[model samples]
Target: MFVAEAAGLDAIAATGTLRVPRTIAHGISGEQGYLVLEYLELGSRGKADLLGERLAALHRCTADQFGFAGDNFIGTTLQPNARTNDWVGFWRRHRLGFQLRLAARNGYGGRLQSLGEQLLGALPAFFAGYSPQPSLLHGDLWSGNHGFLADGTPAIFDPAAYYGDRECDLAMTELFGGFPESFYAAYRAIWPLDPGYATRRDLYNLYHILNHANLFSGGYTTQAEQMMQKLLIAHS
Candidate 1:
């Protein structure tokens, strides 16, 4: 857990990435995870815009290849990253296929599995012409995962850090509401999304929804199914 947290912090602090809290201490006590971090206090709007701009800059820091220097943790499970010059190949193997297989073992069968395969096949079309950089992403950038400093600068925490598409970070923001229009406006002002992103959003978000389904069964299964259905429609 400590190494995962450290990697997360490093990814966020790395050049072209968003700024986040440096973890002072983290450990498991009893049944709960404990962490000590630098505090930042700012409203959602200002912090949102700060995050937006910073994320754009991070995305701009691309590499000729996809994947990271090493593997990291998602929640508690180890996520391996084997380097590849192809973004589509990287996401298909390391992201979608890995998660889908995990979810299937955890009782995610049927349509979800079928849809995942279809999405994998369609990746090339979805991401055509848009080569992504190995941006240092917060990995997990939900509203609850971020905050502001006492001076009102954006401070993010609890990342599933990696070098991948910047949209993965942006898509997580929309998963649970805490961001404002200004944040998106600022992001676009810095780096615009590719034209086909609208079609790809559901596909990208499916990775998270599937992960959530594996982590917490309940409404997440329904949510994952809904997202899969939406992707299938687009594909059809």
Candidate 2:
């Protein structure tokens, strides 16, 4: 696990997609594995246009395949990322299947499971003609994971880093809310998202909400249910 994390971190740095911390140290703290990363400083304009432009450039970086060297951790759980040439297949297996299975184990069955299956089946149609290359992504790129440096440069941290669809990166940004209008505008100017992206956004976000429901069962269950229903309606 540590080796895989190190490899992904190295890949991110090598690609110049996002800034990887200078020191990625691993050690044993009792029975658990610990990873220590350098701290990044944030400035006042965390959502500045320059940072937006940088993130756009990062997302534009792509590869021939859509998978990582190995799976890594997200929040505290292991994310299974088996390598695959097909972007749709990779997403189904690692992103959708893995998250849905975990959610099911945590008592999120019935409608949630059914909708997940449907979404998986519909992925190809949803992403038609969009053969996504392995883009360097800060996989868990929600609002909280990114900040601006002292000079207003964007600094992304706590990456669930991987090579997958750029839309996944954009979808996550909308999930929380730190991203500004300039960010989306800058990204569109560089590499425009597909028209179907709006439809797929809810489907993609369902994975995260379901994961949250599994992790902390509060209002997330209801939220996940609602998202699933919305997707079902769209597909129908």
Tens digits of per-residue lDDT for model 2, 1-236: 66556666666677665566654698788999877777777654755566567677776777767777778877767887777788778778887788888888887788878877887787777676666667778788787776777666677766777878778888988998647888888778778888888988876777677678778889987898788677667766
lDDT of 1 by residue, 1-236 (tens): 66677767866676635667766788888998777876655554456677788778877766666777778877766676788877789888888889889988997888878877887787787776776777767777888877666565777777777778888888888887647888899999888888777767777777777777788778887887788677767766
Alpha-carbon lDDT, every model? 0.76, 0.75
Model 1 residue runs over 4 Å out of place are 23-47
Give the Cα RMSD of candidate 1.
2.8
Cα shift from native, residue 230, model 2 (Å): 1.5
lDDT of 2 at 180: 85
Q: What TM-score goes with each of the models? A: 0.87, 0.89
**lDDT of model number 1:** 0.76
